[model samples]
Target: MPYVNIRITREGATSEQKARLIQGATQLLVEVLGKNPQTTVVVIDEVDTDNWGIGGESVTVRRKRGQ
Candidate 1:
């Protein structure tokens, strides 16, 4: 069995986007790892922007810096 974990900011993506991501991720796992889709586990974690950080900064801050 293969486990896939995906984390994203809570308010950014719509339900459809998340669904598509889950579907595509499972397909990718099946293609690359030869894992059975039924046996594979996919976990999506939705967190607030303040709680999600990268490169020692919050996601909101990162986006602001880029903009």
Candidate 2:
């Protein structure tokens, strides 16, 4: 079984879009690595912008600063 973890900012991703991400990840494993889609696990984690940081700044603050 192949497991894939996807993390994204908890902004405005719709349910449909999240579902697509899961499907796309699964499909990529199937097509590229010959993994079985049924046995592949994809987990999507949504982190708050404040909790996610980059370049010594949180995503929330970075967005506010237009970085």
Using Cα atoms with residue i matched to residue i, what is each candidate's TM-score against the true structure?
Answer: 0.78, 0.96
As a whole number from 0 to 100, the lDDT of residue 5 in candidate 1 is 95
The C-alpha RMSD of each candidate to the native structure, in angstroms, is: 1.8, 0.6
Q: What does candidate 1's lDDT look like per residue over 1-67, in tens digits? A: 7888998788768888888988999999999888899988888899988888988889888878882
**Model 2 error, position 33 (Å):** 0.9
In angstroms, give how far residue 60 of model 2 lies from its true place. 0.8
TM-score of 1: 0.78
Which number leads on lDDT?
A: 2
Tens-place lDDT digits, model 2, residues 1-67 = 8999999999999999999999999999999989999999999999999999998889999999887
RMSD of 1: 1.8
User: Model 1: residues >4 Å from true position, as ranges?
Assistant: 63-67
Which regions in candidate 2 have their CA more than 4 angstroms from the true location? Answer: none
